[model samples]
Target: MGTFSAMHYRCLMPHKPSAHVRRPTPQRPMRVRWWLLWCAMWCLCGAPALAQPAPKVLRYAMVSDATTLDPVSFSDIYSVEVAGSIFEPLYRFDYLARPVTVKPQLAAALPEHSADWREYTVHLKPGVFFADDPAFGGQRREVVAADVVYAIKRIFDPRWKSPQLPNFAAMGLTGLNAVRQRALDQKTPFDYDAPVEGLTAIDRHTLRFRLDKPDPRFIFSLTGTVAAAPVAREVVEHYGDSVGDHPVGSGPFVLASWRKGSQIVLARNPGYREVHYDEEASPDDAEAQAIAQALHGRRLPMVDRVEIAVIDEEQPRWLSFLQQGLDLVLLPGTFAPVAMPGGRLAPNLQRQGIVAQKLARPDVVYTVFNMDDPVVGGYGPAQVALRRAIGLGYDNDEEVRNVRRQLGVPAQSLVPPSTYGYDPALKSEMSTYDPARANALLDLYGYLDRDGDGWRDRPDGSPLVLQYHTDKTLRPFNELWKRRMDGLHLRIDFVPGQWTEQAKAARAGKLMIWFLSWNASAPDADEFLRLAYGPAIGGDNLSRFNLPAFNALYDRQAEMGDGPERLATIAQANRLLLAYLPIKAHVHRLQVSLHWPRLQGYQPHPYLRPFHAYVDVVPNPVNP
Candidate 1:
């Protein structure tokens, strides 16, 4: 392992020819026909050089395959950024991971909520434009308020049938539930019949949303990638099924092209505006300054073009990075700090480096046991006994230190660190590995090895076979689990399956035991509640665990206005989830990323957030 060279040592100098010379005599006649070109060439020769030269292109890799390019359809981080580049969102999470401010390119200001917290009003920034539309023969149209209303309504449209319907209640629109009910009642054409009393088109520049209940995080919910973006109504209605392939958005980057499973290309949007504007400067001046900053330093869309190459495997990407084939390799959370060739990076910098510099952004990893197994009687004695035993047998501290390379903190609560209202008291309840406690629980629950065949049996003389539905990624953890269970005469069956099949089975509640982790949006309790206690579509609640008390707190949190009341409610929900032990909170896993020295402004984001921007990347070559 080597420490990266301190970034300060790198120098930026513009490349300039050592000497200037007069043009060749034969070229003089050609200049007569192109006088403007000749004059521009002469002026360039006299001008002073800059300290830094702009990069022409950016190339990077995505770990997970993008499910879709449609913001309304995809939920993965990769898809959001891919779609985000093409579609402008009303707001985006700030560097601190708070949804307090607007991105400004699409949204002009933070949404204003009524005193009752039921209604929201958003004013559009003037004169922002989308990508050139073929329908309009390459003419860019100014973004309007109607586009905002249409985008939100499209989520609930029966024709679109988006998976994001449940989240719309946060916007105070209750029409989706009615549409869902009508479908269940065998009604023809499950149209959105309920008049959305909450949403109003207050002219063409202002939009308002009225909620059925006072939601403290209503505005925060609207800040989601799906709701925050504005869609062209004509494109959506005209293209119909083909809209995703030919989408339109008002973001900093436009979708130049996408080659499925190969690469996605993006180009700068000419009409883009800065969210952070100098009030004294005109918008045109600000746009020009933004372009200059983007092409220069500190802030960037640093390159003229961006190419996101699709690379599924990590090792190949790592190999390419070592060979200098890649500009940067976005490492997933799986890899830890490893030795690198000193020649490639730097050797002496490795041994004395700060631990924080080598690690990834902190995130939690959890293992959820499926309590609703057909053989286990759905959270009955067998499943509870197994979960209790497993909880008491595994050493979380050791896993955090050894397996995760001390890059993570042991987590006992579902709520991750750095989030609002995360309680320290919740840490006390996590159970460490205690064989005696595990054995006692199993013994008390009627598990005994009466047959003396090295396998335990239940009170009814049936073998206590523990089946774990896992993937290859979890093989090491599975081995540890198997070894630990062996001491208690518990037979562990490691069932292997493809990742997709295993995930489908887990979602359907067909798996006996499985692993689950909430890669949260903001480390909030609501993030966990949505997956754990919200509505169970299938086996997603593998533990078959539900507490009305927890749901009540979540509901109360939704009803209560933002501030202390809501914060307390969230903390209570987190604490309750920990107490119930539905899932073992392992530790907050850090995302480890690698980059070439040429790249700059490579700040790490929280968890799985995709913060790719050409404005923020630059090369660190010792010399060109």
Candidate 2:
């Protein structure tokens, strides 16, 4: 599964510091002779004469506060990005590889699979130790095969209610689902000690998994940071529900301190295993070559520390990047024009030696209709017609041009570009904008402007009003939606709420219409199709779409390898989704990230969470 971020407008808020903040000391101007004398003395003294401070720390800014440090508890990109540094998945994709390649991280090598493709055995690298924590009784805890088993089992524990349970359940792991059901039926705590035939610790260094069926996409799940990362059992037993607040792992960085919504500090893990930075970049990529030249062969985690501040509002985040308060910033599409005018770097930023990296994200942004809601729910022809009309009325191309500033491509289907199942040749009903056709469809479905109130009424003659759940951050987009709906005499009222609150409401089926984006975690089409799977409702399937045909096709595709058969099934699934109109696919976003010249080896992976192990901080006299 991929990470989803609620689509909303983040208003630019003015940054205000605390009243007790200290002012910096003024620098006195020195004479040219004095400066020349100091330089001469430094040159004469050579390496031992002058002492330099340690390499600079990496200061990054996040748009919102991470909801959790517990990997499986939440699926938000922000949480994944933050927790990823502290956790290590068994396998990770190469940083600069074009055709994504999985490389072992915590595992000694890739898993060896059985002939039937139902069993997988992984061997762990020795000497990997967890960060020092009070939960370990002042002793270093080496990550072992049992730690991996414990981590996977936690997802099945009913008490945790992990959102990733569906992904694991789909694996058809023998005896695991039965255990989850037994615990739920008895209303008792999950028996962590109970043995499941699927998961086994063959030895201190080897872990094995036995699935009931063949699933070629199973390895993709292992590459994700959520269920694959090893977590110490003692630490979870100590912190319990509050484990998100305290994270201990064997990664390049460890969480030093986190102040809720304010700031986060991560220090280099002193006990981390020795790993070096190395990568092969494409010969055509000059930027990659430049980064490789500056950082290749350097020890992992080139920076001493990583400090991140949560600035939910975009204006302050952008200002911080401009004023040098932050070393890197992920520019939102709303502020793309300000940062990169006409799809080119701003002259001012270029003059200041700042670099902007732009790439097409392997993701899709769309508005989902709650299939459980009374007003918009059901699979009847009338309901489907109403949804199709609404989708046709809203102009995604216009939104991309005006709101997104051409920073995205109008989506024809749920699957975004660059993914295995995405079909660029397929044209969808939602991709067209025909107001007359939309109005005709509504009229045919008995939806008309009754009582001459200038708004359509339901078939039952009740007042029809679509309550759109959104945050202040999405005010601009909502305004555009209102205008579009008004043309068809459809009323849409906005219900303002925070991203976190709206996300909770969405999961509870309390939303009529909501906008969000899903970024793929792997290169497979399953990541996108899983969002509409019937069984995934209330989990990744926020829409609660439960079409039986779509569900069957989803299952069929899951069982097949990545081939023509899988692609054919995927096409069938896409057709069903478009026909049902459960979601109005909007666009695939383009990511534009900005960073200082001092920050090197910064490559953006569309699917991979932020990994700073290979990043270095070079001294820049001009920026300093």
Candidate 3:
């Protein structure tokens, strides 16, 4: 039960020092002369002594296994974090910089935008090569502008059915939509070779995009690795429908080995283009300044390998980090008190030289009322009243204090703080909690107790029961909700299932109500607002909310720059969402990460996926 023994169970290689052998010194002058002659001969040969290899593996754990490796096929945060290492985007947020700044990753520099914001031109960096694979036919292919074009075209293909297609579809590309419709109508495979005037490759390294309408935030969309990463045509053709299992990209790391539902190993990509660690931290942050000084000019991918174990339970994940079986762990809210008592590092952890990084994430968790479900769905006055009543009855402030342990902020609107277009001064009906008003609304909207059953019946006199889909992990929160619903005489039932299953059910419009969350992919409010857009119903819009007024405001704000006009449009959209009550926005959870002192250059990014290109691990000394 020691740390080293625990590491064996997690498939980690423990250090074993070499045994030392000693020889007696020369006792006589003759023996001394013989030893002196041997030393002289050894020095003349110029041989080097054996030394131990430096530690170069970063072992970590995740709360759940990644569902897919395809960058565009899934929208989950776990999958996106893994795909980010295998795929390279045109731009990425700087690792140590505050206030989120994007810098060129695969591109040579920032894209050139036209005055009207309808055109963008990007130039790829030379010498970038994809990982070696059988699909290349033993030929080394360099990344080109056509590769980027082909990747974007795959998103529009019906066969792949990328979940992030709406992001590109909203751009109003000149001829892209027509090609997509043709493929859909003919029931044939998409033509990747077909020339789309809107997406053109001017040269081997230059790619240009032409939009029909003005889009100031179009550049931010390209920063996502899911839709913007380059994909080789031959790789896709060879892998066919199983392309997600075989990811090949020009990134810092390549998928070396994988054991599904167990562990994943990533090794440094030898073919990756030359890149170095360079960033600026806040002037007042001493810890950040110290880390920057140590890794300012080092070559990227300081670690030679990365091993991630799938530890679904929080207790084991926490123990793994405590025992040094894992290098990093994001502390769960339930264990915050045990790990960082009173919002400070625990005494035992501090004695062990463990460091904790706290951050306010740009994310929101909410319960979605499926608009397609007859029980809890619609924009009518009665449906809105019911949803508002439930929203008001379920006190988020209590949930934060009891369940979250004061680790989150109660959300006022869907737009999280620190993002563009977020209005801190705006108040909405869902932000308030009043059980008295909730009871009155339910009673006035036709829900009443019939036959002295103690439970209220639906307006149509059918047995009223609201089914909520959730997992065992959220039993505490579900119990609280059940108690609140009982006070209103509303019967409730819990549907227990895994997170993946519930996500699929929600997307298929089979669930009545479900708890879900969204983490921002960019610093703009457009990323969060587009989740409820009408065109994204089958994709990011799990609630299936479709309001023409909200859509109009969303579209208008998409074209306007960050200013008073755009802020006003965003406020209008928020009002529409609040009025309809498609979802009950909950809270913005705080992120707390714990790691060993040896793990340096560790920074938390609200939106950017963890790439670990600049992270370096110092080796611990072996016991003698």
Candidate 4:
């Protein structure tokens, strides 16, 4: 799942320092004629002959700090994006592909799967070495198949309580779940040495995964965000709970320093293998082709150091970008109207050598009502009516136009556009905003103003206040929500808190209502649907929706291949979501970014977390 900042911004390319040649000091000052000739040559060539190059440092900013850097416990996309560079997933998506396609990462090539698609065998590339850390006793550590085995076991260790555990349900490894269950049942530490029938390290450079069932989409889990990224056992053991502070991996970059909730710095991994930059792209896609031509045969991670700072406020973040403190800035929606008016960069900004990338993110933002909360929870008709009325009362179109600065499309369903099973032609109550209809529904359901305090009460004459939990930055959104609820004579009170705390509270089902957004890690629309699945309530299904019919349909669709029948099943499931109103999908956000012209390979792809690896910061800031 993608985090909020990951949804909009990432990656600032690096600039290398120029090396100055010591020419015996021009100890003797040049004569007037020679100096004049040198000035003429400089004017003609447009570059000084002895100028030193800029240091290859990429300075970037994200709205929030990463909650942690441990791969097994990575909750938000910020953590995923940062840890991704330091860790080695067996596979990743092709960099320039429109629809995401699997590509080898630490693995030498794509895995060979059995005909039933229940098993996969991967061959790891030899010579890949983890960055040197104290955990390794100052010795080089080559990533092995055993490390992959150990990495997978960490998720099931029961100590991490990994939010990523729910993702493994789709994997259905033959004996892994049994080990997890045994630990849960006996209250014993997970036995990492237990011989699991599914996971195997055939050799130093080989891994084999055996599944209990067919899962053609299982390959996507190896994208490093899910479960299979290789983390050294010793590093995790050495750091213990503090492993998030010291990530050791066999990827492109190594963590140099970190100040929690402030800044993180990564230096190029000296142990990184000799990998060249190459990306697959459609021949007809000119943008991809151009990026390919620009970065052809360059070394991986052209940047020597990446400094990511946490600058949460929009105004300061924009100001920092304008003042050239940041090499690139992900445009917050509030400034979209001015920065990229009418879907193009402002001419004034464009003239300053600014370039922009507009991407249609495969994601959805929605309001989640806790189904287990006393005020909003229950399967009763009155509870359902309360939710439906609230869903109908809120104006998502207004949010898109005003709050989002016309940077989003009001969602018709949870499924985002440009992904499998997303139907652009379908329409639903999710896209409509009618206070009148909402009032009638509430009135019919006996949610009246028993106390006559200008706000309607619950059906049982209880106060009907929606204690909405959100970040302080959502004032515009909260104002609109309060106004909409006021129109329906319902009450809503905002509770502002830190994003990390609110997210924790959300997972524990301690909040009545909160805003949540999800970006697809893979191309499947099923990822969005998992948010409403009954069994995932404590995990991804924060809404705690447990309708039996909907649950049955979710299971049915999960088992089927991506075909017309599965699409029909998914559409039917969405109807139940609207009818029950556990979550109200508001929009599919548009990600707009602004970067300097010197930042090469600037295309933004949400699926690619290690974006800094491909982009390069040239010595010349004005041009690539």
lDDT of 2 by residue, 1-624 (tens): 222223211112223547897544452333454466556654454424345688569998887778889976887888888888898888888788766778888889998998777899889899999999999999989999889888888999988778778778877889999988999999888887899899988999898899988877677878956666999999999998999999888888899899988898889999888888777677788877776776678888888888999987878988898888888888876788877898899898898888888878899999999998888878998898889999999999999999988888899998987789988888777679999999999999999877898899998899999999887778779989999999999999998887777777787788899998899899878978988888877678899999888999998898887888889999989889998989999999988889888887788887788667778787664442
Per-residue lDDT tens digits of candidate 4, residues 1-624?
323233122221112335784444354553554566655654554442455665588888988888888888866878877888888788887788776678888889888999888889999988888998989998998989999999888888899987777767546778998999999999999999998878989989998999987777777777645357888899988999998888888888999999877889999998788888888777888988998987889999899999998988899889998988898998998899899889889999988888888888999999999999888888789999899999999999999999999889999999998788888898889979988899999999999999979999988898989899888778889999989998998888888898888887888889899987887788887788889988777678889888889988887887677789999999999889888889999999998889887677877885776687888888575553
Top of the candidates by TM-score: 3
RMSD of 4: 10.5
TM-score, structure 4 vs. true: 0.90
What is the lDDT for 86 in model 3?
85
Off by over 4 Å in 3: 1-49, 52-55, 621-624
Cα error of candidate 2 at position 361, Å = 0.3
Q: Spell out the clash pairs found in candidate 2.
A: 8-473, 9-473, 9-474, 10-473
* Model 3 lDDT tens row, 393-438: 9989888888888888888888998799777777667668888999
Better of 2 and 3 by lDDT: 2
lDDT measured at residue 157 in model 2 versus the true structure, 0 to 100: 91
**What is the alpha-carbon lDDT for the whole of candidate 2?**
0.84
Report how far residue 17 has shifted in candidate 1, in Å.
37
Please tell me which model should have the higher TM-score, number 1 or number 4.
4
